[model samples]
Target: MAAFPHNRRMLLMGRHPPAHPCEGTFMSFVENLIDQVARATGLGDNSRKFVGVLASYIFSRPDGFKGFQKLFQKAGLGGIFESWLSGSPAMRDINAGQIQNALGVRDVNAIAEKAGVPGSFIGTALAGALPLIVRSVTAGGTIPNGLPSGLAGLAGKLDWGDSKVTHLRGNRKRGSFWRWLLPVLALLALAYCGWQMRGKSPPLGTPAAATAPVAMTDGTAQSVGAPTFAFQHSGGKVDVSGTLATAAEKFQLLDALKSTFGSDKVTARLDVDASVKPASWLDRLKAMLPGLKAEGLKFAFNGDAVKLDTTALPEAERVAVSAMFRDQLPKVKVEGLFDRGVEAIKGLKAGYSASELTEALNLTTVRFDTGSANLTRSSQDIIRQAADAIEGAPAGTRVEVGGHTDSQGDAARNQLLSEQRARAVADALIASGVPAERLAARGFGSNRPVGDNSTEAGRAANRRIGYEVMR
Candidate 1:
C-alpha cells in the first residue's frame, strides 16, 4: 500500500517542523489544517473557506468532539468515524436526512448561517469531510487533551505535484531540460487530440427536432400557486370551502367538524390539490384545533386569520376558548362570535346503576387547565354529579379513574403528568364520600386518545379523565 506523503502526515498530525513556533490559538491551528485538506480534496475556494469556519465552530463547542461521536452513533455512521480514526479504508458515507435528525434542525440552521452556505449543502459537505477532520484531530486513535499546534510549517513542506519515484542504482544527475520537455510535449499532444475531437461535436444550443415539446392537458399542468382553504362558522353551523392539500386532511377536517357539531350542522366543499405539499408548521397549527372543539367552540382557518364562533357556547367557555387560541396559535388573528348561551348538560337518572354511572362519566366532559393536573372550577359541578351517581350504585362496587393527555409534549413527561392528573381526580372522588379502597387510579398518557391527536380537538378529547366501574 502507498503511504501518505511525509508533509501530508505531519499536517494531519498537527505537527510543524523545528523552525516554526506554535503562535496561534487552538482554533487557528484547526482552521489551517482544514484549509489544507479541503484544497487537497479539490473543494472550491468558497466551500473550502466555509469548511474551515464550520470546523472551527464545531470544535470550539464544549463536548464538541464527544457530541459529534454520539451523533454519528445515533445516525448509524459510527463505523465511518471509527474507520477514519483507525486509518482504515472502510469509511462510509452519510445522507442528508440522518445528519439533519442527528444534529437537530436548530444546530444545522445555525451552522449553515455561520458558514454562509445553504443548509442542504452544509449537510453534504460535513458528511463528506467530518470523518477525515475528526480522524486527523484525534491522531489515529486517541484524542489529544487540547488542540494540536505548529500548523504553520505545513505550508512550506507540501508538494502539489505527483509523487516522484527514486532510482536505487546510482545517484542520477538531476535537473535536465530534455526530461521536462518530453512530459510537456506529451501533455500538449493530448490537449491537441482533445481539441480535435471537440471540433467534430455539434454546435451548442442547436435545437433537435426530435426533442419537440408535447402539449399537456389542462388537468396535467402544474397549479399556479398554493391552494387556499377557508372556514366559516355562524350560529351552530360550520361551512368549510377552498382547497385542501390531501384527501386525508380534507376527510379529517370534515370528520372533526361533524363530530364536534352535528353532522347535519356542518357542510364542506373542499377540493383536493395534488400540487400543494403540506407545510409542517401548518400541520402543527391544525393539531391545536381539536382541543378547542372539546371546549364547545369552533374555529375557521382562512388565509392568515382564524374566525372563532362561540355563538352556541356559554360566556365562560367563549372566554376560555379565546384564551387558548391566543396562547397556542399566537401568529393568527382571532375573531369572536357575539351570540352566546350555555348548553345544558344532560342530567343522569336518579337511580342509575354502577354500569350506567360509568357510561355517564364517559359521556361527561371534564376539562383541566393547560399543563396542570388541577381540574377547572367549572368542572367541579360535573364531578359532583358523577360523585352522586357513583354514590347511588350498589354497595361494595369499585371504580377505576383513568387519566390521559394529548401527544403534544415529551412522552415520558406526559406519562408522569397523566398519572398525577388521574391521582388528583381519584382523590377528588374520594373526598366526595366514595370509599378510598373502592377506587383505583391509573394514567394512559397520550397512548389512548379517543380522537386524532393531530388536531387540537382530538388532543383535548385525549386530555380527559375516564371512569370504569367494577364489582
Candidate 2:
C-alpha cells in the first residue's frame, strides 16, 4: 500500500504491481506442516509449540538470519547452513548442539518457558524443524525477504509477534499429514507444469513478471523504527514511501531519486526519526540509485535486508544490478537475488599463512561509523569471515590489527580514535575465538596513508582496518 498525491500524472506501467493476496493460504500451509512435523516425531506435547514459535520468529523477521548465521560461524557450523541458505532441494542436517549454539541458551530458555517445555526441548525440536521450515518457504531456490505471500496483513491475526527475544508463544491442537498432503502435491504439480512449459507459447495477455513482494515494516515491536526505504518504478515515474532515521539521510535519498528520475516525477512520503540509528545501506543506496532506472522495478530495504524485483529487466541487466547490491551489502540479505549469470566465488581457503590472511582481509576492508570506532552492520560479515580465516592460520603465526584515519580531523584525536578502532576489531576477533596472544592491536592514525586525503573515496580507503603478519 503506497500513496502519491499532489501530482496526478498517472504512470502507464503494467497492470501487475507488487501485490499478492494469496499469501495467507501459503502461511496456513506452513502452520499445518509444523503441526504434522511435531506430531509425527512424537517429540513431546509442546514440541509443536516451540517449533512453530521459531518458525514464526524467522518468517516475520528474516534479517535476524544474519545473527543466526554469525552465531553458526562462531560455533564453526557455518558451512552446514549452505544448503538451506542456497535453498537446495535436500537441506543439510543440523543437531541440538548446533541449534543451541545458534539460538544461544537464554533465547532457547525463553522460548522453552513460553512453550511450557525445557530449554533442551526447544533446541532438539528446532534441530529437526529448522531445515524443514527453510526449504519449504524458499521460492524458486532463493529465499524471499518479506513475509509469505499475503502474510504481512495476517501477521497480527496469526499471532506472529514473538518479539520477546522474538520468541512467540502459540498453541496448535492438530495437523493431518494426509490432509495437507494433497494441497502440497497439487502446488508442486502446478509448479512442475509451469516449469515444463517454460519458453513455450504463452496464453494471450501474459502478466508482467511478478515483482518481489514489498514488506515495508511499519516499525514493529522489534523493528525499533530502524530506517526503512522502498521505491517502485513504473512507466517512467517513481513512488517512494518509508521511514528514515535522519533528515539528512532522507534529503540525500530524495535528492538521489530526483537525480535519477526528473525532479518533478518523484512522489515521496518520507518521515525522519533522529533517535534511531541510520540503516547501514543508506550511502550505498544513494550511490546505486542512478543504476536502478529499470522499468517496472521495485526496491525495498527493510532493516538489514533488501528485496529487489527486476522482472521487467533482461537477464544481463537484472543480474548485474542485483549482484552489485549483493556485493555492496554483504551483511544484509538480498532476497532471491536474480538467478541468471551469477557464478559463485570461493572464499579464503584453510591453513592460510599470516600474509595470505592479510591479503584476503584487505580485499574486503572492515568499516566503522564516521568519527567513531563502532563497526557498521555492513562490516559484520567481513569480520565474521575474517575470524574464520584467522582461526585457520598456522599455529605460532602472529598478526597485527592496525587502524588508520584520514587527515580530516585533529591529528591527536584521530590517533586516539584509530587506536580505539583497532582495539575494537581485536576484541571482536578475540570474541570470535582468535587467541589474544596471537594478535597485536595498534594505530597508524594519519601516518601510513594508502589513498589521497582530499577526496571522499580516498579518505574512505585511508580510514580502514589493515592486517599485517607480525615479524
Candidate 3:
C-alpha cells in the first residue's frame, strides 16, 4: 500500500541487470505479496485486510515471526504453518522473497501451472489465494540474511518486469573528493556523538561536594542527617555508610552507579535508619543482553561502593573468582574509583589469594550427551528449571558448565567429546539470552567420576552436568 521510489541503481544489481528487480527489497516484497494474495483469495475485502495486516506485522517484527501461526490458521492452512514456526534447522533458511512472489499473483492459475496443484482445487478452495497463503509464512520471519535462495529468486521472477535499459544505466560516478571525504566525515560525526555521550557526572570518588552535592537545611541536617547507601536485598543486607549533602545527590548516586564485574555483589537499600530494614532496589541496577545480530558486542554496567561477600560461594567457582573479576571488569567502574581503580582491580585479580579463588570458584553444572553435543529433547525442562534458579544469583556468581562422561573407550576421546558437549550446552544457554562471560564450559571426562564405571545407572549419573556457586 505504501509505494516506495524505485531506485534504478539497486535494480541494476539484480541477476539479469535490467530484467530483474532489486534483490531483497522489503517494501516491494510486501507490496507484491499483497497484490498476489488479493487476487488469489478471490474475496476482495478479505484480501485487502490480509495484506494491510500482514505487511504491518512484517515491518514490526525485527526477527520476522510475529503472529505467523495465527495468520496461517485464519487462511485455513495450518499444516504447512506448523513446519515453519517450530524453528526446525531446515525451516530456518526459508526465503521471504518466495512467499512475496506467490502473494503478488492475481490468479491461482499461475501457481497451479507452476506448483502442480489442480485448477479445480485452486478455483474453489484456494482460488487466487494460493499466492497469499504462500506469502504468509509458517516460519514467521526466520529468513536468513543473504542473497535470495530458491524462494527469493521465485519471488523476484514474479514481481520483476522485463529489461528497460534507460533506468538501469547511469553515466556519473561519485567524485574523488566525495569518496575520500565521506569516511572522514563519518568518523568525525561518530566522534562528536561519542563525545556528547561521555560521562556528565564527575570522575568516580571525586569529593561529593564538588558536583551534585546535596544541600541540607540546618534543622533537617541535625535530625535525619545526610542520606547514605545500603546494599541490602529481601534475603540479605550489606550497609554502605557515606554522607551525601542532599537527597537529590543521593538519588543521582543511586540511579547513576551500576554493577562492576570485580565489585562485590550487594543490593541497594534506601534506609532512614540502620534499624529499619532495607528495601529491594532492583529497579536501580543496570545490566544488558546480547544483540540479535552475531557481530554486536555485549555490554554490562556494575555499580560502585558494593563488594561481594566471597565466603558464600561453592569451592570450585571461588578459585576462578579473581580471574573473572580481573579479566572482565577492566572497563567497569565504581563511584570513588575511575579507570585507575579498574586497573588496580585487574592487578589484584592476577595475584588473588588462594582463599579468594577458592571462594570465587563455587559453581553449578548441567550435563550433555557424549559424542554429539546437541541437547536431547528430555533435557529442556531440566535446563528451564536451572535457568530459573540461577536468574537471581549474586553478581559474583559465575556458572561453569562441566561436561562429564562415563569411563569408557579412550580417555582422550572421551575428554574431547565431553568438552564439546559442555561447549554446546553453554552455547544453548547463551542463545536462551544468558550472558556468555558469566558461563564457562569444560569437559572433565572420567577424571571426576562420582560412580563406578561398571553399571548403566552409575554411568548415566556420571555423565551429568554439575552447577556450583562461585564464592
What is the lDDT of every predicted structure here? 0.54, 0.60, 0.38
Candidate achieving the largest lDDT: 2
Candidate 3 residue-wise lDDT, 190-232, digit = tens: 4323322454632111111222212212232222432333332
- Comparing 1 with 2 on lDDT, the higher-scoring candidate is 2
Error of 1 at 24 (Å): 96
Query: Per-residue lDDT for 32-147 in model 1, tens only?
Result: 44554443222344544555444444434445456557666777767655665533433443444566777777777766675565654565555445655665455424543222
For candidate 1, the C-alpha RMSD (Å) to the true structure equals 23.8
Model 1: colliding residue pairs:
287-456, 288-456, 289-456, 289-457, 290-456, 290-457, 290-458, 291-456, 291-457
Candidate 1 ranges beyond 4 A from true positions: 1-346
Which one wins by TM-score: 2 or 3?
Answer: 2
List TM-scores for all candidates, in order. 0.29, 0.39, 0.23
- What candidate 3 gets wrong by more than 4 Å, as runs, is 1-370
Residue-wise C-alpha lDDT for candidate 2, range 264-284, written one tens digit per residue: 356555656566668888888
Backbone clashes per model, in order? Answer: 9, 2, 50
Candidate 1 is scored at a TM of 0.29
